[model samples]
Every structure is written in structure tokens, then in C-alpha cells.
Target: MKRTIRLAASIAGLAGTIVLAGPPTTIINFDTYPDGSAVQPTDAFTTQYSTVGVEFNGPGPSGNSCSISPPNHAYAKRIVASFVDPCTGVASVTSYAGTAQDSCWVPGEGIDMFAYDRDGNQIGHEFNAGGGHFTAFSFPQPVIARLDMYCILQGIDNLAFIAPVPVLRGDLNCDGAVTSSDVGPFVLALIDPSGYAGAFPSCDIRHADMNCDRRVDGLDIQGYIDAIFPP
Candidate 1:
């Protein structure tokens, strides 16, 4: 089914707080397989970059039809999921992040499903599975070009990746609004680039640099604060 999911609320701190929205649920059904064995699904998707294919955790049950569902009641810039033999092994899907390595993910180990951006950043992840349930992941910003999944000791059936929604430019904290809360993430970006970028992959540095000074420092802090919360 063709649909779109947008973020209605801002994400929490670097800890990751999925802000659910009231957008339509998008579904990527992989039920069009040829009921056979295949290393990767032939269902290639056309993205901004070159086309990409769906990757499985390993050479599992040839070809199987499955579906991926995004977070329920969550406002996400982008969402992705992999359909595999639930709790069997690690199943995953890969998609195109973008040309630039400006993607990031919330870090977690031993997750049932996980996503990494073009820059090799773990944008999202989930742990454990209850049967062949639909395990999904979300990204703060839309910089996900390639998505990959794993479960530890299982195989995957199929993979599906969704399109990106819209996002406010300077909403660093992703609280649906750019207010004082953004200051924490903005400052984090300035002190620890890697940590900040990885935690809030969607928070573009350029947007955080309110004064357009090409840097996220104390200098831009004031401008950012004023711009979002103007007097």
C-alpha cells in the first residue's frame, strides 16, 4: 500500500523518544515474491541515489512474503522494517540513506532490528521478537539511505523501507517546536560532534548554526535561541 508517515511531535533527548503523529500508516508489502529460495529479494526500490535491493540476515527460507509496519501513533521523518522468521534468527533490510554521510542512529546492541545511515551510523534499532511480528525502527531525521537488520541467531524472509516525511529546520530536540529544549542538543553538537550527530542524526548542523557561522558553537547559540523564540 502507498502512504506517508510524518512527525507531528518533536523527539525527546539523545535517549530517543519516538514522537507519534497522526499521519497515515504506510505499508511496504513483500508478498510479491516467487515462493522460492533467493539470497536477496528482487524487489528493488528507486531512491534519490542509485537503486538498492532488500538484504536478508542470511540465506534463509528462499523467498517468503512478509510486511513491514511503522511505529503506531509515532511522528517519524522516516521508518523501516524487516519481515523475517520471528525470533528465529536476525533478519534485516537495507536502503539508501543519501550521498552525504549526514545520517545517524540511536545506539543499542542485540536488537532484533536496526538501521544505519550512509555514514555508518546506527540510526535506529530494536531488541527481541515475539514470533514473526513486525519489528520496526524510526529515525529522527531523514538521512537514511541504506538500512540493514540483524537478530543475533536467525534468518530473515524479506525487507521493506519507507519514504521520508517533512521536518522543521532548526527543531534540534524535535519536540515539534524549536524552543529552549533545543539548546541541550545544539550544545551537544558543538562539544561532541560524533555523539551529537549519532544521537540526533536528523538535526542538521547547518540548521543548528543559527548565525550561519559554519560552526555550532556558543556564538550560534544565541542566534538559534532568538530565532526559534524571538522576542
Candidate 2:
């Protein structure tokens, strides 16, 4: 059964608004992959999983190397002799805010996990030092785009993450309301997307896709006007 957790306290301010509900949670347990299949390399796992909103990378001095163990579990192979310096595992999501996972480590081996935002800022981090058992690690915040895991000979399973919330249509300013105030930003999104993003770093320019054709062009102008000045 899927488990649901409470939203982080940081986003509590969005309550009583159209953004009250949190984004859906997704879990990748590695069981779907064929037994003992490779999990790294763009073609093997990254590309296939990106469609589901997550990307994986296992980088080492040699090359990327990770695989699925029997039954279910993502095992990172040790490319170096010392357990202290192990392979690095990276999982990236599209504007995700938080992530968690169940991990198993060898005796005296553990993992260090770090979360980064869209701008490459470190938003959260967690570390587990003990070993020989499963441990649940989590980093909940408001915006996370990447997760880096460092461990030696560890097994990772049940990776869970919260997807990014969809931006409200026509709410270019992300103020939870579509009003006249969005006019300038909407025009900016249609004309100069980069400028619009710079003007509102927390807002999604795609909100200006008033016609829902996947682009903010001249076709959306009438719809946007109608939203701001309803008849």
C-alpha cells in the first residue's frame, strides 16, 4: 500500500488557498527492473525513468556503474578499494521539493545524501553512519531539483519523492490568484521568457499558457485578457 505523509511545515502558508493540496508522491522500488539489471548509464535507467520525473546517475573514477540486485534493491558497486571513498549516486527530479529512501549499508558503511535546488543551492542534507541494516533518510523542503547520495556497497530501495506542484493557469505571479496584477508578467512571459523568470524567480512562466497549447504566444493573448477582465 502507498503511504502518505503530512506536508512540510514550511509550505503551511499556502493553506486556505487554491494551492492547499500537496503534489502526489511517487515511489520507485527497483523491483520492476529485470533481476540483476543495470541501473545506471543514460539509456539503461536515466532516460526510461526521466519520463516519470526522475533521473539517476552513478559516477565514479572509472565510469557510471550501478545495478539492481536480486529481488529488489539498487546496489552501488564499489569502484574504489576504500569504503570511505565510494561511488556517487545522483537522482534528479523536475522541481521536486523533498525525497526519502530506504537504504541498507554494509557494516561500518553508511551514506551521505544532499539535496539541491533548481539554482544549484544546497537545500537539505542527511547522513547515516551506522550500518548492516536498513535506514530511512529524508530531506523535506520547498524546492529541490537534485539529490546526491555517496555510499560504498550500499543497497537503496523504496525511493520516494514529492512531485512539483502544477502552477495555476494564468497566475503568472504565483500569488494564488489570477488578477489584473498578472498582466505585466503575462506579457513578459509571452515576449521574453528569461526576463519573466528573472522577474519572478519563484513563479513559473508556463502559467501564462492561457490557451493550454503548451506555449505562451499570440494565441493566448485573448484568453489571458478574458481571465483578467471577465465579461
Candidate 3:
């Protein structure tokens, strides 16, 4: 079943602050896959879930294996496991472009989960002493790029995450609003795309396309000015 969660975020613009709804939430229960399905070869697995914007990687640097298993707990209908040896395996789930938030999972064994941001900084961590329960991990913002699970015996199910919010046009600063604050970044995006990116790592410079002609050029100046000072 698909679920849509609406989170109101305050967006401050030249017009003032306004409430904007967040993007939908995606839940992967692994029920669609047949029992005992292989989840290895990270690239292939990622392509399968490309529409949902997530990737699964596993077995750590040792190059073990991971697979889907039949239900063994009350928390999930199916689970993914990476237990080549006791406490010697690692599995990871990464959101495309580092745009996922509020990741949760159900574990079948004791596991240590670590959450990282887009820049590879550790943002959150959780350790479940035992299995067969629901565990949720949250970070300071919706910038979670990856999640790693180190396990003694791993079985994960019912993985869920909040998708990234859509970029507001002309909101080059990525503050969820189009305002005067975006002018500087917008200029940078047109003159030096890489510089704009470095200045606002989490932002997509394409948002500077105020005229919406699919290009960030001088033509967008008027449109951006209009957004800041609408008639």
C-alpha cells in the first residue's frame, strides 16, 4: 500500500513566510519480491528500485552476499539478510542523491545502524540489542544519504523513508522559498554553476531557471525579479 504524508514546512520568501507540504513517504516491505530473492550486486538492485530513489548495498568490503528471506517475525512479511558470518557482515541502503529522511526498519537480529549525510558525515546511529522489533532513526534534517547496518545476524524488513521535497522554482538557496535571498545564488548559478553548488551543497542550481526555459541564463533575471516583487 502507498501512503502520502504531508509535512508543513515554513518557507520564508520576499512575500513572507508560507507553509509548504513535503513530499510523499515511501515504504518498502519486500513483499513484491518472491521469497528467497537475491539482493546482491548493488548496481542491479539499485536499478530495480530507481523509481523509488533508493539503493541497497551489502556484505561490506569482504564481498559476502545478501538475500531476501521468508517471514520470521511479527514486524514484517519478508526480510533481507546479510549474515555470511556472525557480526562480520554489513549492509547499506542509500537514497538517490542523498534526498531521503526519517529512515526506519525492523530487524531480525541485533544490529548497529549508522546514518550518514550527503557529505559522508555520521548524522545518527542506533543499536538494537535484540531483534523482532521496530526501530526508527532520525537525523537533524532530511539530508540522509545512506544507512549502514552491521549485524551479528541480520534480517531487515519494512524499510521506510520520507522522500525529498520538490525544489521550489527560483529558490536557489533551497530554503523552500523564492525570495531576495536567492538573488546572489541565482547569479552564481548562471555565471559559475560549480561555485553555486559549492556555496549551497544541498541545493540544486537548476532552481535558478526562473523563466523555466530549461536553462539558467540572463533571460531568467526578469522572472526572478518578478518572483521577488510580484505585481
Candidate closest to the true structure, highest lDDT:
2
**Mind giving the per-residue lDDT tens digits that candidate 3 earns over 1-231?**
122222222223422421233333455544342233543423123223433444454222112123222322112122122111011111223332211111223444455666676567876767654434445555445556666655545445455565443346777887878778888888889899988889999776667766544567898889888888998
The most accurate candidate by TM-score is 2
Predicted candidate 3: what Cα RMSD to the true structure? 13.5
Each prediction's RMSD to truth: 16.5, 11.6, 13.5
Output the lDDT of residue 13, model 1.
37
TM-score of each: 0.30, 0.47, 0.41
**Clash count list over all predictions:** 29, 0, 1
Off by over 4 Å in 2: 1-24, 29-105, 115-125, 128-146, 155-157, 174-176, 194-203, 209-231
Off by over 4 Å in 1: 1-29, 33-111, 151-153, 157-160, 164-231
List candidate 3 stretches off by more than 4 Å.
1-25, 30-109, 116-124, 129-132, 138-146, 164-169, 173-177, 180-192, 195-231
> Distance from true position, residue 75, model 3, in Å?
18
Per-residue C-alpha lDDT of model 1 across residues 48-109, encoded as one tens digit per residue: 11112222222222232221221111111222332221111112222322110111122332
> Lowest summed lDDT over 10 consecutive residues: which window, candidate 3?
82-91
State model 1's lDDT. Answer: 0.40
Candidate-wise lDDT, in order: 0.40, 0.52, 0.49
